[model samples]
Target: MGAQVFRAFRNFNLENRAEREISKMKPSPAPRHPSTHSLLGEQLRHHPEIKGEIASKNDKLLALLKDVYVDSKDPVTPVQVKDAETRQEPKEFRLPVGHHFDMMDIKNIPKGKISIVEALTLLNNHKLYPETWTAKKIAQEYHLELNDVNSLLKYFVTFEVKIFPPEDKKAIQSK
Candidate 1:
C-alpha cells in the first residue's frame, strides 16, 4: 500500500511541473517580413487610404519647396533714403519726384562717359515716379541713346547683374 502511494505522488509531482513549464513559455512574436501587412496596421490606424494619401502629399510638398526656395547667387541691396533738402537733380537727367540719383557727378565719370556701374547706380536710386521704369524710360531719363543703354545692359550682364533673363530680353528689345 505504501509503495502504491509513493508512485502516485511522484506522478502527481511530474504533472504539476509540466503544467508550470507550459504556463511560463511565452508565445512566439508575430513573424516580421515585408510581405506581411500586420506591422503597417499601427501606422495606418487613422488613415484608411494611407499609401495613396502619403504619395500625393509628398508630391505637393516637393513642389511647394521648389517654388519657395529659388536658387539665386546675387546679393540683395538695401534701399537708401536721402534728405529731401539735400537732393540735387542731375543736369543731363531729369530726376523723377521722390527719386534721387546715386553717384550723379558726371565730372567724376572715369572716362568722361558714364560707366555701366554708374548707369545701374542711377537706375537703382532713381525715384521711380510710377514705381517702375521701362527700358525706354530709363534710357531717356539718363540722357542715354537706346544703343548706349543696350550696351550698358550687356555690361551689366557680364558683371553678373541680378536681372532675370526675360527682363534682359525686354531691355535689349527696347533698344
Candidate 2:
C-alpha cells in the first residue's frame, strides 16, 4: 500500500478566515418592536385608591421585616444543655416486676426465630463444642427450622475484623 501524506493544519488560519468573512458581511439593522400598552399602569391610573393601599401594605411589610432582622455583629448564645436530674423520664410500657424471662430460652419468641442473646449463646456453644451443638441439635433445642439453623451457622459470625486501607499509600515514612 502507498503511504498517504495528510496535513491536518495545512491551512490553519481559522480565526483569520472567520474575521475576514465577518468584515465582508454588513451588520443587520436592530429589530423594530411595536409599542405595547401596560395593563398594570392602566389599572393603577384608573384606580388611585389601589395604588395607595399597595404602598401602605409594602411599607408595613418593610417595617415588620426590619423588626425581625438580626444584626451580624450581635453575639449568638450557645444552647443550654439540660441536666440529667432535671430531664423528664420517658413514659413507655415496661414488663411487670414479677414477670419471669429467660435469656437463653425462646419461650415468647415467634416460631423459627431467635433473639440476639439466644443466637449468641447458640453460636458460642457451637464454636466451643461443634460435635455437641451441631445444626440439627441447635435447631431442635431452639425450636427453629433445620435449614435456618444451617444458614445461620454457615454465614453468621460472632464478630468480623476488617483491616481498612491506609489513608496514605505509605502509612509510615521512615526518616
Candidate 3:
C-alpha cells in the first residue's frame, strides 16, 4: 500500500512538472508587415486628426503623380542626369519650435540641480510623454523660472526642435 501511495505522488509531481514546462513554452505572435499604411493604421487608432492629415497628404501625392505620369507628354527626366548637374544646396536642419532640449551632452547632467543647458539636453535626449509635461512642465521640473524656460524654448525654436502644446494628443500618437 505504501509503495502504491509513493508511485501516485511521483506521478502527480511529474504531471505538475510537465504542466509547468508547457506553460513556459508560450508561442510568439506572428510578425506583422512593415508598411506606411500599417504604421498609419496603428497611429490613426489614437489620433484621428493625424489620419485625416495623412489622407490629405496621400491625395496630394496621388494628384501630383497623376499630373507627372498621366497628363505630361514630356520625356522622363533621368535621376542620374539630375544628380550629376544638381548643385549641392545647404539646407539647415532646424529643431521643432518650443523645443528647449539639446540632444548632445544631455546624459551628462546630474539628476538634481542641473544647469539650464544640461536640463535642455536631457529634454532632447529623452522621449517625453507630452501629457505629463510640456516645455513649461520641463522647466518646472528643473526648478527653472518661467521666464528662463521661455527664453530657453525660444533658443530651441531657432534650432527647430518642433515643440507642441502638452494637450496635443494627435502629435503624440503620430510620433
Candidate 4:
C-alpha cells in the first residue's frame, strides 16, 4: 500500500515538472536557404565590375587555347633512352674469391673500413703472429681506428678445433 502511494506521487510530480519545462522553452526558427537568384544579385551588387572583367579574361584564355591548336607543324621526335643498368656504374667490381686479402683487390675499396676478406686475414695474422700483427700495426695498415682495432682483437677470434682420442681407445664406451 505504501509503495503504491509513493509511486503515484512520484509520477504526478514528474508530469508537472515536465509540463513546466515545456512551457519555459521557446520554439526555435527553422533554417531557410536563400535562393540562387537572390544570392547572385547580392554578389553583383557588392562587385558590379567583376563579372565583365572575368568575361574578358575568359575570352582571352579561349583565344590562347585556339592558337595552341593551330600551331603544330613541327615534327615530334621520340627520345632514345639508354638502359638503366648500362648507364649506372657497378657497385662492386670484384667479388671476394678466398679468405686472403690482396692489396690490389682493395684498389676500389673505401677508406677507414676493411672488407670481410681483409678482416679474416688480419685475424689469421694476429693469431699466427701476434708480435707482427699488433693492434697498432693492424690499425695503421688497415686505416682503422686504434680503439676499434683493440676492441676487434679483444672480442673477435678465429675458432680452432682440437680433437683427442678417448683415454682408453680399446674400450668402445666408458661407464
Name the top lDDT candidate.
4
- Each model's RMSD to truth, in Å? 32.4, 19.2, 28.8, 16.4
Screening candidate 1 with a backbone cut-off below 3 angstroms (N, C-alpha, C), the clashing residue pairs are 99-127
Ordered from best to worst lDDT, the candidate numbers read: 4, 2, 3, 1
C-alpha-based local distance difference test score of model 3: 0.61
Cα RMSD (Å) between model 1 and the true structure?
Answer: 32.4
lDDT of each: 0.58, 0.70, 0.61, 0.76
Span of ten consecutive residues with least summed lDDT in model 1: 103-112
Ranking by TM-score: 4, 2, 1, 3
> Mind giving the per-residue lDDT tens digits that candidate 3 earns over 73-165?
766579867897998876433322233555454433333345555555645643345455566776656655677665665565323466776
lDDT of 4 by residue, 1-175 (tens): 9999998988887978998998896988975567876888899999999788767657787888878855556664443333533576555433332434355545555556778777888898999999999999998787778999999999999888966777878545457
lDDT of 1 by residue, 9-127 (tens): 88877978998999896989887886566668766876768877766657777888878956777654443333544576664424332234543443333222455555656555443
**Model 3 weakest 10-residue run by lDDT:** 91-100
In terms of TM-score, which candidate is strongest?
4
Q: lDDT tens digits, residues 1-175, model 2?
A: 1223234364578789888998896889875453324666677789989978866657787888888956586554443333533677654332221223454333366556667777887887898899999999988787778989999999987864766669877555449
**Which of the two candidates, 1 or 4, achieves a greater lDDT against the reference?**
4
| Backbone clashes, each candidate | 1, 0, 9, 0
TM-score of each: 0.23, 0.32, 0.21, 0.38
Error of 2 at 171 (Å): 22
